[model samples]
Target: MSISTSAAPDTGRGPAEHDVRTQIIEAATAHFSHYGYDKTTVSDLAKAIGFSKAYIYKFFSSKQAIGEVICANCLGQIERDVLDALEGVQAPPERLRLLFTVIVASSLRLFFQDRRLYEIAVAAATDDWPSVQAYKHRIHQLVEEIIQAGRAAGVFESGTPLGNTSRAVYQVLVPYLNPVTLPHVSALHAEAPEALYQLVLRSLAPPA
Candidate 1:
């Protein structure tokens, strides 16, 4: 992806600051992913795009802050995919199906585009990035709400544990849809996402 840049402001202050900040983030992600997180430096990030380290610092206080922003942006993209799928669908099953399909497709596509970045971010995630973690929880809550809806409609079996099922679905996905691991599992090549979805649905669906 091209690193989008912002024009310098006449007043030397405005949303351009925010746009420049985003540019720094985009550049940092590309650099950090290409070179492992440990190897990437502020000078490298700044020089990679012909900007100065001082200039980058004006926006990001530190490398960790930049990493947090990039990590949060990745989660935000996933949230957008979920919200887009949730829009316009009223039926619980169809809505749930769409949510599953969109997340799988979008995640797979994104991971394929930059597996190293995701890998690095995943490693960093265990350290507890609250913003990213919160976004992830929001997405999980959205899925849980859909499960609850399905239960209310009687389309899915009643009395199913929505929280546990939602967590299970999350587990099945993070590995299955991930590009780094998908190649090792042969079944994942054929109908991985659908199979996983069916498993979750079976657990949560009302009695036959």
Candidate 2:
């Protein structure tokens, strides 16, 4: 999954307008971090940035629109981290392991380090935000790509349909990947990711 810029619809504005939009996003990020997303309103952001509510609306249609951009940015960083971890790893097994480990660690770091920003991710998942959906789709695509590579290398069995295998692997990852379920699983099964990763490797292995 590549790092995506923003999930919000592009306005096709000029550079000056784009600068204003970036300013609005940066201000909103700080405000959301300090005050929490649900507690803060667009009016609050306008005041914090010395812009009128009407002026803020020129950049974002609603508070949720601003939240979507922040959420996309957060998820994008996770994708970049995963890509970096997989760099120079030719083995499909190692690639799959890094994909699972890096994503879970990155998410946990976000939850602990910038918890308020993490709340935005929770809301995105709960509300079925487009950014969340797109993130999940990209993850699924990555899993499928790894599975294809493994099959081509004869590292994984080719009997199961590719789509089915990919979805199954993704399902195994959902508990860790989902913001809502992550804390719960982490609390109960801190070692679940490693255990699950090994299970997946065995399941994908070609018959003896």
Best by lDDT: 2
**Per-model C-alpha RMSD:** 5.3, 2.8
Model 1 TM-score relative to the real fold? 0.74
Best by TM-score: 2
lDDT of 1 by residue, 1-208 (tens): 3332232112122244477776776777778888867688889998887898888777766676677666655656766787887888899888777777777676666656776677655654556565546765676777778877887788876564667777776676656433345446534534766776777777776777
lDDT of 2 by residue, 129-175 (tens): 88888889999999999999999999999999999999999999898
Give residue 142's lDDT in candidate 1 (0 to 100): 76
In angstroms, how far off is 18's CA in candidate 2? 1.2
The TM-scores of all predictions, comma-separated, are 0.74, 0.92
User: Counting only residues 3 or more apart in sequence or on different chains, how many pairs clash (N, Cα, C under 3 Å) in candidate 1?
Assistant: 3
lDDT, each prediction:
0.66, 0.83
